[model samples]
Target: MSRTSRVLYLIVCASPRARRIGELVGRAQARGWTVCVIPTPQALKFIDRPTLEEQTGFPVRSEYKQWDITNPLPPPDAMLACPATCNTGNKWVYGLADTLALALLTEAIGLGLPLVVAPALNSAQAVYPAFDRSVTALREMGVTVLYGPGVYGPGPPGSGGRPYDWELPLEALQEKVVRPERRK
Candidate 1:
């Protein structure tokens, strides 16, 4: 039987805003996309790898193993770096690949695949020089960087401290992953 070819890579960062990664993953899967998550060590603290693995029915890789290339997983049709922390976003925009997510993202961009990033940072820090340069670099490299909405407080009121009704680049991701590629 042929398998459905929908695949997406989820890259999270170590930040308070990274909490939304799971919800985004769930929504993606419900849309018939197979998600492969690559979380940083810091992101793992916010989410559970086992839970992600079970939900996606794929391995949730945190590290790049040199010897694991015997069987390579198919490249995702698109990559969504959700809740892109201030640090991770800047690092990736400047072509820093110290982490597995950045490395894979670099390769994805090289292959001309769609890369959508949703940046999550406070107003004060988001306006920093490094952040500005990083955003510019990513745009120059054809990476779609979505600016976060201006929401104050811990999030939802009932949550006692959590971002509420923030903008996610879901439409952008759906546009890429669900669209059928045109054959030449």
Candidate 2:
């Protein structure tokens, strides 16, 4: 096992690709990384909550826990926001912590954690200048924003697009996360 003690938080958004996020969890676990799922409020409808809990052995959270309560999940070494919708991307860029997912992402950036974002949006939405600016800003802050043909390209005009590979985020995660062997 490699880095079994480490944690990876997979923040899901309200996109069709989010339904298949379980695949990423399995891949992360195979790499001996504990996977924690934190979906956006609207993302709750896209994921299989109980099944994910069964697979990861941790509750899937969509909101902040009650105050004064100890955190149930361990701190994450890295974070990936897959199926990150246009709204999520824009909000995150603006430092909007309206949802648990965005809040986690904002904090992760400030903490300098390895972060990856694979956004799913149509060509129409992706064309918005704000989207490009957001992506650039996130990348400038050391976040790996995966948004290309194979990762998260724009779809058709009106319809919301799907991601080429749901596993790309995990692939990005592997390449970016600091490994035990690389520790100073």
Candidate 3:
């Protein structure tokens, strides 16, 4: 499918960066993607639900819809988890779908949808062995995980450093996932 017709599920996690997700949504729309915002339950507190809903023209969904209800968002042609917190990342690797966001991510892996994850955490969190293992496991599962060096590296604990470069995940998706699909 052409990029203009593609649907992208932009999953936001419970990080300070979640506050700036509107910027990412705007950028994705500018690139012709029909973007949908899915935030983790905790991320709800960080983001402006009304603004994002208006921005995307879709409800900001954090929980599963009732069985009788129809899904409001389109099926994703691709998925991105930006500011993917250590908690969510690890849970996803283990196939823990306790939340709607995790359920979608876990299902996306099985569906073989083009997926990219940019982890956001402090150096202390990154240092854990589980973090390294999660990154490796996700990559082995054919998920594009943008971490370390030029992509993104965790800052020190309590540093509250510069905001995450939100565009990195979108850029990666365009190059690694979207562009290749176009050639087919």
- The global C-alpha lDDT for each of the candidates, from Candidate 1 onward, is 0.70, 0.83, 0.86
lDDT of 3: 0.86
lDDT of 1 by residue, 1-184 (tens): 1248577788877666565566778877777767888887788887777777777777778788787465244567888887677788777766789988888888887887878877666666766789878877887777777763442312322332255333356666765555525110
Q: lDDT rank, highest first? A: 3, 2, 1
lDDT string for model 3 (1-184, tens) is 2344789999999888888889999999998888889999999988999999999888889999999999988889889998799999999999999999999999988888889998889999998999999998998887888897877888888754367676788888887564645311
Number of colliding residue pairs in model 2: 0
Query: Which numbered prediction scores highest in lDDT against the true structure?
Result: 3
* TM-score of structure candidate 3: 0.92
Q: What is the C-alpha RMSD of each candidate to the true structure, in Å?
A: 4.6, 3.4, 3.0
- Candidate 3 residues lying further than 4 Å off, grouped into runs, are 1-4, 179-184
**TM-score list, all predictions:** 0.81, 0.89, 0.92
Model 1 steric clash pairs:
154-161, 154-162, 155-162, 155-163
For model 1, the local distance difference test gives 0.70
| Preferred candidate (TM-score higher): 1 or 2 | 2
> What lDDT is reached at residue 15 by model 2?
84
